[model samples]
Target: MTQPDDIAPYDLAIIGGGVNGAGIARDAAGRGAKVLLLEARDLASGTSSASTKLVHGGLRYLEYYEFGLVREALGEREVLWRIAPHIVRPMRFVLPHDERQRPRWMLRAGLWLYDHIGGRRTLPGADGIRLDRHVAGEALEADYTHGFEYSDGWVDDARLVVLNAVDAHERGAVIRTHCRMTAARRENGLWHIEAGGEAFSARALVNAGGPGANDIDRLAGLVPARGLRRVRGSHIVVPRLFEHEYAYLLQQPDTRIVFAIPYEGDFTLIGTTDADHSGSLEDVHIDARETEYLLAAVNRSFRRDVTRNDIAWTYSGVRALVDDGSGRPEAATRGYELPLSDEADGAPVLSVYGGKITSYRHLAEEAVDALSKRLPALRGGPWTSKTALPGGDFAATEQPAFIAELNARYPFLSPADATRIARAYGTRAEWWLEGAKNWDDLGIDFGAGLTEAEIAYLQEAEWARSAEDVLWRRSKLGLHMSGAERDGVAAFMREGG
Candidate 1:
């Protein structure tokens, strides 16, 4: 195995490429710390990409009396949108009043608290909307006469992770994808790390390993006070269920809620069932029961009766929640805990227990703050709150105008393709379209507006190596392409393109 050329000791070594780890790397790098991030797989190949894709305060958590977590996440919703407007856009969720579930008065109270708790300034407040009068009601059954509309944000989950990695790399952090930490030991007040057939050293180590957090801790020979409860959440994508721009939050008979959101221009993404999982994390998928459950949830709320045949795709992610000893998996806290171990004779290790995407930035801030005290070399205070991720320079309200400008600049591009590019890359789309005057300049077309120029850009800039990385994570073009087109992409990637 060839050794990595730069073996200099780093201020921080992060062991996961998921959202939390990437966020920390970006934060620490911006703080002038020499950082190194190693990932066993593609960024966000695990739980980060498989979220419900909403950046909101967990409304259901209000019942659990987790007001602090809800308030913190609610505050982050707008902050995240402001920082990454290209990927994080405001969304209105319509929750049809279910008499069998919570009472209308209680629901209204929760919404009121949700609006005021997070100092909401930009996003609209919650209000009751008559489904019959609202555009969202057109696709719903006639029985759903009334519902409540609340504000939240939607994110391209996988891209968010990659953007953090990109920003971290730009700020002088060494980000190595497909690099797994085989062993780590504290030697002479430093972390001696072995990963990807190479050896490295760092003053501090962070275990932001998501589902594999415990395994990472064991590799470092430290036993935590609390273990992780590996809970599997699954989602299904089907051909468009509703035509409206608004997403629906349907109440289940079992006191759970499922979201049916518009997805990929021509499909509806529905999901998220929480179940205790004890299987291999590598082999997670939506089982038959999960599929049936999701379909049933959609069938209960939508006028269209969707079956298994309508499912376009399915994906599952397992979250490593701090085992709070909750009887139900759904009741587990999405909040995170940072347990830092610093001994007199050993280096420091910070293990992130559990966290949600909405609160990742705050988690990183706190994690870095803790480590900064132990390592004096880490300069500067929290700066990520005011800084924008790469490609996210415009204000949140200017996205539509930005898209319009992109279309006008690239007249040869179709409106759909232009819009997709504008949303996916934001102002950075200009870089991909830099020298291209027409469609032919983009080189070979891979269907669904996936041009060779874009593929090359992803490979060169975003650390995308496989067809799956480009098609599924970087962009959801796989949903729009045929099997032959996908195979062509695979062939291109396999040829070292």
Candidate 2:
């Protein structure tokens, strides 16, 4: 078996390349610690990617009196938005209030608290809007007379994880993808970690395994004080169903809210049912019931009806939420918990609990603080707040100028490619598209703006290992490709293309 030889033991061994793990690794690496991030599968392949993709303070949690979590998440919103303006831009959500549901006064009160809680500056605060008077209310059912619009940010959740990994690597952290941390144990006051059928010694271990956080803890021979509920959330995509870029937050009969947002270039990404899940992690998938549920939810509020046949694609993932023992999945806390186990004469494992994609950066910072007691030698103050992620070194407020500048640099490039590259990669897109004087210079086209050069860049730089890694998680090109085109890309990858 392969092993890291003669090199100094890593300061921390992080299991799981999900948002929490990548965030912690980036935090640790930035703090001058030797870090190694190991992922059993692709980064954000679990709950991270399966999220509703909003970076906001949980407005609903305000009703539950989860003030601290909401405030922290709300506070960190601008921090994340500032770091990755291209990926994490402000999104306004229209919340159509139903008289049958919560009352108008109660909803107004909650929105007021949500607005004031986070020290919100750049994004507009929530406000009441009449359905008939507003442009966003055009698609809503005629009976829905009253609504509200609030500010939040939408993120490419998968790319958020990849960007964290990229930032970690740039900070001198070693990243191992497709490498599973199969086992971990304590040895000689340090951690003995195994990954990809190999072993290593680490001074500490961070179990940011998302749904598998508890499992990782058990493998490290520590008992968890809490267990995460594996709540499977599924999303169904259809051809663009709404006119506005603004997302809709609708209340269902079940008291759960569903989001219908414009996805990619020409599709509506509607999702997310919070069904309690207990199955093989690899077998997590969207079911016919979930499909019907989401379709019904969207169709209930919109003038257009979405049928099962309208589904362009479907994806599912399990959210590892800190089970407050609330049998109701919707009532489950969206806040993350860091539990440090006390064991005599061994290294401690910091197990991360429920966390959202929006608060991942703050979650990472908190996890690092949990590890501060052990390594007094480790310089630990605070860093990641104002720091930019891998490609987001731009003006925090706008990107039109950046896009215009990129077009000037590559006049021969199509507007679509140039715009996408500028938005997704920011200033770094130039490095990948270097020397490509024309469309043909980009090598093979994988359809939907994806090219051979992009694929190569993903594998070589972004830790993308499979076709799904590129198409679904890393980018949204899967929504535009035929099955045959996807199969060809997979075949080419397997053949070392």
Best by lDDT: 1
Query: How do the residues 1-497 of candidate 2 rate in per-residue lDDT, one tens digit apiece?
Result: 33466767788889999889999999989888889899988888877787878888878787678899899999988998899977888889999989999899988888888899789998888889999988888888899889899998888888888999999999989998888877777877778888888887788888888888888878877787677898999999999987788898888898888899988868999978989888889768998899899999988999999899889988898999898888789789999888776766578778888988778888888888878777653586779998899779998776778888888888876677677777788878877788877768888987877888889999889988889888888987877889988998898788887
TM, every model: 0.98, 0.97
TM-score of 2: 0.97
Stretches of model 1 off by over 4 angstroms after superposition: 1-6
TM-score of predicted structure 1? 0.98
lDDT of 1 at 7: 61
lDDT agreement of model 1 with the native: 0.92
Candidate 1 residues 255-297, lDDT tens each?
9999999998999999789999999988788888888899999
Q: Which prediction has the highest TM-score against the true structure?
A: 1
Distance from true location, Cα of 362 in model 2, Å: 1.1
Whole-model lDDT, candidate 2?
A: 0.85
Clashing residue pairs in candidate 1 are: none
